[model samples]
Target: MKHELKGLYAALLVPFDKDGQIIESGLREIVRNAIDVQQLDGLYVNGSSGENFLMNTEQKKTVFRIAKEEAQNEIKLIAQVGSLDLNEAIALGQYATELGYDALSAVTPFYYPFTFEEIRDYYFKIIEATQNDMIIYSIPGLTGVNITIDQFKTLFENEHIIGVKYTAPDFFLLERLRHAFPDKLIFSGFDEMLVQAAISGVDGAIGSTYNINGVRAQAIFKEARLGNVEKAYALQKESNDIIESVLNMGLYPTLKAALGEKGINTGLPKAPFHPFDESLRPQLKSLIQKYNL
Candidate 1:
């Protein structure tokens, strides 16, 4: 578990029943696929792709525990412990850290227009409480909270706040972040732009699509970082095709369906998020076979 925290990680997709319960069996299978089959460097558990926001605290803890047990320290695990309730975030951070998660990540608190000072304090409290390495999860599209370079400087002041899951499409900001914090680990959160981010010098990536297309993702990152833009771009284009289809069909459900086709028992997305459209099943199946996912 003391592995280098820099590499391709699947932003883990959870298997949930219609009752919004974690399907433990399916979860184990998915973990094994990521480690033994996909051969990803890590698993970013309970992040957005796992529908963390939709699960209760205890359910989140269940995911943390299950992922750790299944992984058994074979692969790196970064638990996303962020919540609107600061205490919940801290408690989950403590839970994950104690469970031996390699690192803890928290999305910027959203829903209320929290001040920058308040946001800074949120992360500080979690780190102080858990005393574990932290990765700032910066996804501006969902949270609407953009951390500028100066703000990042303030956050990085906490030596324990190791790096960030940079999800936005702002290449300029990414280049600036790389130049500004060369020592910190910067993980690209968007799969479609993995090549671009790798070209811009991202240390690694954490992506939802990696759950299905991880081998290609790893190749894209490796080739791009090695200055093989042509080779990297080729893989990126292939990945983008899969991503474009998945997004159009529905993200979580389509992913679950893809895994289901492989007999993984990936149940369904939590409520309010609709299940994969049965009408699109043929297209999803075709995508899976076409890409050999």
Candidate 2:
């Protein structure tokens, strides 16, 4: 089936208990709130914001299953099934497809320094393994591997490869891609960069900060799309200010805490990912209230 995937999607936060277990109930509630109340365009499950790297295969599958079940087809779900292991990535892709995810995205492989040819092979392997359409995730900073314009063209040559979740700040390349592939979908990956991305013709954005600030992000995109630069910039500035606080307080913990403050109770981050400083909760709360998040 042709997918109607576009617009502002939140890279969901996975809530874990103190013992580092996925808090399924809490997560279900968070997803529910994100869809039912926040009214976001979609959910980007198991991405960088979702802490996918820290979890194992079983844990990742469990998250995929829970997110799908709770979403109940109410909103679009893009499963980030990418991993360092090619076989494992394929398995997750097939699993998510079977579970009814709307689309699948995979990060460029990291560590061990794979060549561009290897990266090309990796995406080819994934597209060949599953019938699901793919979105190439190009986050150069984290994965240390970037799909250059030529590489992206190679991947998009696959009829099933629909688009990309581009996280870098390279507007020149972004402009080039938009100009080259006007028909393909390109969702910006950085929440803070949504205005520029939207102006450059990005279809939408998938971001961690959107988990809390989706309403405003949606406004920014809507206004920008309609040529309301002043309004969009004002909203973008507000969103960026909040994101700045999130970066200072910590991304995952601040997200969890904000969710809890909203009464969703996402608990805390998994171990080795430290909790937000308790002292900063007041500051976070004030910021959230200030932004009406």
Candidate 3:
């Protein structure tokens, strides 16, 4: 269990064609880049970076199947089955489990002020149905729901609630969690704060940027773990420069654009999220040149 996960994972970004249909071939290219070029530890399929929320049921399953098929034992895979719909979440969980995903992560149900018990039970039901290890996906910034330390403790009581993909910026809670649950897996979510989280003792990190810039992120995590703060900080600073540019340009689109530079054919972002701004191409290219991404 300890070795199943614990390293950098690209929260995969999916590509879509003009008609808003998934470009399967492009997605396979991204997976190969992550494995062959970036040499990442793993891939986190169908998460926020995948523009998952914008996709429907069939599309999500398609991503799970494609990622699993492409990755195909090359590296670990965590399927993000979280959805606003609990039934959908459970169904996805079972599907991923059947596909033999390394683990299943579900975002805390959002859009309503659900009690901790409600949230806790949601996780329980998914675990019971799927009978697979679960990682709590806590990104309060996006979900508008924050799980307290006590809430995490309660959830972890089940043991099947293996760890968390903690996406918030609260280092205090991060430190507390590290000390409190030394045995569980904890993957940091933000690329900009990778060094900080590594210093705080997270098991690993998952980021959208890792899809293209994982070579540098791997260096950052390695330096920090080796107690080389100065080098790690330097790398973190450099990575954040790229992340800032990506965020400014639009996270998914800008990331796909980086892959596009590598001649991977990663398509544009799904509908309503807008495309890579043609005007921003030069800025993104500058980042690619600077980072050698």
Candidate RMSDs in order: 1.1, 1.1, 0.8
What are the per-residue Cα lDDT tens digits for candidate 2 across 1-293?
32389888989889998888899999898898788767798999998888889999999999999999999788899999888888999999999999999988999888878998888888889988987888989988887886778888888888888999999999999999999888788999988989988888899899888888888888999999999999999999998999998998888898989989988878888878898899998898899889898
lDDT of 2 at 54: 90
The count of backbone overlaps in candidate 2 is: 0
* Model 1: per-residue Cα lDDT over 187-285, one tens digit each: 999999999999999889999999999999999999999999999999999999999999999999999999899899899999999998999999988
Give the range where candidate 1 is weakest over 10 consecutive residues by summed lDDT: 1-10
> Residue 58 CA error for candidate 1 (Å)?
0.7
TM for every model, in the order presented, reads 0.98, 0.98, 0.98
In order, the Cα lDDT scores of the candidates are 0.94, 0.88, 0.93
Rank candidates by lDDT, best first: 1, 3, 2
Q: Give candidate 3's whole-model lDDT.
A: 0.93
What's the TM for model 1? Answer: 0.98
Q: Candidate 2, TM-score vs. the true structure?
A: 0.98
Model 1 regions lying over 4 Å from their true place = 1-3
Q: Over the stretch 1-293, how does candidate 3's per-residue lDDT look in tens digits? A: 75579999999989999888999999999999999999899999999989899999999999999999999999999999988798999999999999989999999999999999999999999999999999999999988998888889999999899999999999999999999999999999989999999999998999999988899999999999999999999999999988888889988888888899889888889889888898988888888888898
